[model samples]
Target chain A: MERRSKITPILLLAPAILIFVFIFVAPFIYLIFQSFWHYETSYVSKQVFTLENYIKLFSDPYYWRIYWRTFRLSVISTLITMILAYPISRMISRMPPGKKGLVTTLIALPMIGGGMIQAMGWMTMMMPYGAINGILLSLGIIKEKMTFLGTETGILIGLVQSFIPLMSLPLIASLGAIDPTLEDASKSLGASPLRTFFEIILPLSIPGAVSGMVLTFMANLTMYVTPSILGQGKIQVFGSFVYQQAISVGNWPFSSAFSLFFLLIMGVTAFLSSWITKSIQKSIYKGNEA
Target chain B: MKKFSMFLLLFVLLCVASTVIASPAEAADCNWDEATCEILDGADFGGRTMVVGVWGGTIEEIYRKYIIPEIEAHNGKVEMLLGGTSDRVAKVYAERENPTMDIAYTNMFESAKGIKEGVFEVPSADAVPAYADLYDVAKIDAYGMSFAALGIAYKPEAFEGEPDWPDLWKPEYKGKIAMSTFPGSDSEGFLTIAGYLAGGDDTTPDLAFPKLAELKPIPLFFANLDELFMMMDKGDVVAAAVFDSYTRTYIEQGANVKFSYPKTPGAIVTMDTLCIVNNAPNRDMAIAWAQMSLSPIVQEAFAREIYFGPTNSKLVLDEEAASKVIYGEEQANSLIRMSTYMTDHRDEIVERFNREIAED
Candidate 1:
């Protein structure tokens, strides 16, 4: 009976283990190996072992600048998404019974159809003298045409629009999970609506905010098609850089190294966010215990 | 009950296995060759199958109107393996060890790179009899194949007159001009154009840097032809460097785009060539297609419909089509043939461009 039980678990676990090894672990190991090798020019060119790729990456200011720019863009994009998502999420969470469905449908609308169509719509709307430009000009808000699609501002706009959904879902869940009586009690205790938000709601929603931030941040970091298309190759994000290295240069080894490097950065950010969220939770609960 | 389910599964498996085993044998049954075409007057492949990897879009119509009909006449089918240039190249490269294509088309630089990497075999000219009539320019055998040039394109409405290479550097056209991010010779051509105008000697791009830097804050740097076309269509850009085939099509489509040969010898020329994969699936079919592609009739058809200049000099086309094409020895000699220097200095020039020109 004991042996049969042990075998059952192994059988069930086999598929998961196989998938993990095949999809994630194998590629990662290959990436690490390739990073240390260079392409040899001989027939079936031998991969020469070298630390030069890493050394070159370390020495180049150009690559470092690209990395810094990518980090700044990711953080800025995530922050904007969070700021926009927070209120909408709270409002939706507070929506009376049946209206919840409508709010969700509205939020989920962008995700329902293909991304390409959504991207195309944004392209037409965001171009110089495009719909946004025309409307702004007619409203006498701006005189000169705004260069949106090719600029960092345009990239931010696209990133924020695409990632609002990722942020909103978690925030909505966290906000929904909050007991409304806490807010009610704060307001009842002579606190203003704003004060209640700061005192009760904001502190309670730390977990979701952290989750949303991490999700949006990672999405922004690994972003590819949208930025490449909208930026018109003007903007060089990390994902696009990896793509160029792998395909254009056929430097698979360098691309692999770069991908691992990006993954590490993303992992650190995720860990930091999680740690901060946990610390905030501990402190808030500790005060409750007192 | 368990046994019944297991038997049912086995039965289904057997059916799938049989189909998989049989499909390829069926596909290969149809003979694709010149002999088949000749004996049948080249009309026998109507119901047979032939697959080619191509850059899709409006360019697909070239196949739809011309190549398909010819293939269909011979009882043949042509499947399009479509994507961007990089995507298609990666796919073909991955399948280099065991190619899935009978014929493949890619840009000239890509084809050259592929040849150097041993992703493709040097084409057999004997198989392709029409290869004899190709322009001397096409004969430049870096990648073991011929290439077509993408002469300069401009907005006729925007320019008061036909502006040559130097006119791009003129104060009037400053900031109004757009150029694609040319990784190699294309950039060299632009730099050279500015250099020659500035009266600098030596093919080194150092002399051209200052003049190019003068056109500060180049509003856009397009990644692809489609993006460039979109910019031109909206009048966001005026005169820009582009391929003749692409510009010609746009002009025909009622766009305000016009193309001209920049008078300063050779302004810039891009070559799009043909190649056979290193490990093609149907070797017999591939060699046959390469030969067939070089036919004067096919070359003329490629020119008239696709607007790509035929390598075959004897291939006559309509006057309008012929006028746009730059073929022949005199034109070839006049043009500055791109070299390894252009490729090697790419990073430095682009870096300078980004720092000096883009920052503004």
Candidate 2:
């Protein structure tokens, strides 16, 4: 029976493990290996191991500019998404059960159409003669049309809009799990609403907030379509740059190296974020003990 | 159970009767010798299916309307994989060993790369009878189907007269002209034009970049033909470096656009080639399809319908149709062909373009 139980779990997990190995792990390993190869042309790559691809990336100031731009835009977009998501999620968490579901669905409606559809929607509204410009013109906000296409500002707006749901769902889950009586207890003890929120609610929601930020930041970091469509090939963010190298220029080795470096940056950022979250929670617990 | 079986019998009988009635009508209309038809009468394909990769939109529509029926008449099936040249080339490379496509339509540069990588079968007069009818330029790496001359396409209302390539540098047109992305055929043409204007030929290609940057036109970079047309129609851009074939289509569709082949050096020519995959599954059908595509009838139709300069030397168009395309030997000779230069310096050129012109 013990052997059967062990075998049963392994069997049940076999399909998932096989899928992960083939789809994710194998490709990831190949990508790393490919980064070490030398690119010859579009359809040709030599297998002789070399670090030329990485050297090329590090040597060029153009690549550095692109990487720094990608980082700055991702950070700004994630921060804005988190700031907007928190209050909305908190409001929904405190709502009546029926109303909570309705509000939650409304929060997630933009995401239901997927990223490409949302990007296209924004494209329709953000074009020079689009609805946004028309509205602004009617209201006499400006005499001339504003250039939204091929600008970093336009890409930032797209990133924040698309990633807001990713930030909100985790926050809503964590906030909803909090016991209402704890807030009531603090209130009954003469703590102000703002004070109770700072002392109790905020600290308890750190994990969810951290998770949301990490996911949104990671997503925005590798964003391709939104930036490419909104940026119109001028912005040249990290994701689109990789695409230009891999697909357009047919420099697979260079693209692979670029991707691996981007992976390292994302890993470090995620690690630092989690470490900071842990430190904050430790301090909050120590304060309570005191 | 009896009623269900009777209904099934009736449905099967109906389907058989419909096909039986449809086959003869289709077969009778098949003109075997016609260049536009897909199949010869009495030739049995044994139900073989040929997959063709071609550009979508009007091109694919024309093929479906005129070509597929004849193939179907001879018991052959055709499946179309519609996408850009790069998309199709990437697929062919990824599946090189056992390619999913039988025939792929690609630009000259990509076709050259494919030939170098041993991804395509070299065409010969024996394999494709229409090979005899192609010009020397069209017979290089693959069977060239059509060519387009690149020039300035502008709004008729925006300018008093036809603008030359140097007019792109004028201060008034800054931030108003759109160009295709670097590493694309259109941009490569623009680079060559810039090089010519700078008094540098293919040998001194580097001089073109500085000249291009001097224009300082913060142009919208179009990723596809559809986007270029959309921006032009919406008046988001006033002018662009575009192909004659595409601009002609837009003008016919009443986009208020006019294309001018610059008088000083004339337009640059880009060719689209059709090649069979190295290990294509349906080799015979693939060869036949390639031959049919280059047939005089099809070539003439393409020239008339889409303003594509037909690769078949025998194809003769009317004066009006010939005016829109690079038709004769004189026009062909005058047009700049940059296939060799582009193939050699494509990587450096794209990298520099991204760094300087596109980013700036």
Q: What TM-score fits each model?
A: 0.83, 0.90
lDDT of each: 0.68, 0.84
The sequence of per-residue lDDT tens digits that candidate 1 reaches over residues B172-212 is 76777776764433445676666666676325567777877
Q: Give the best candidate by lDDT.
A: 2
Clashing pairs in 2: none
Going through the candidates in the order shown, the clash numbers are: 11, 0
Supply the DockQ value of model 1: 0.21
Chain A agreement with the truth for model 1, given as TM-score: 0.92
Which whole-number lDDT from 0 to 100 does residue B185 have in model 2? 86
**Superposed Cα deviation of residue B136, candidate 1 (Å):** 5.0
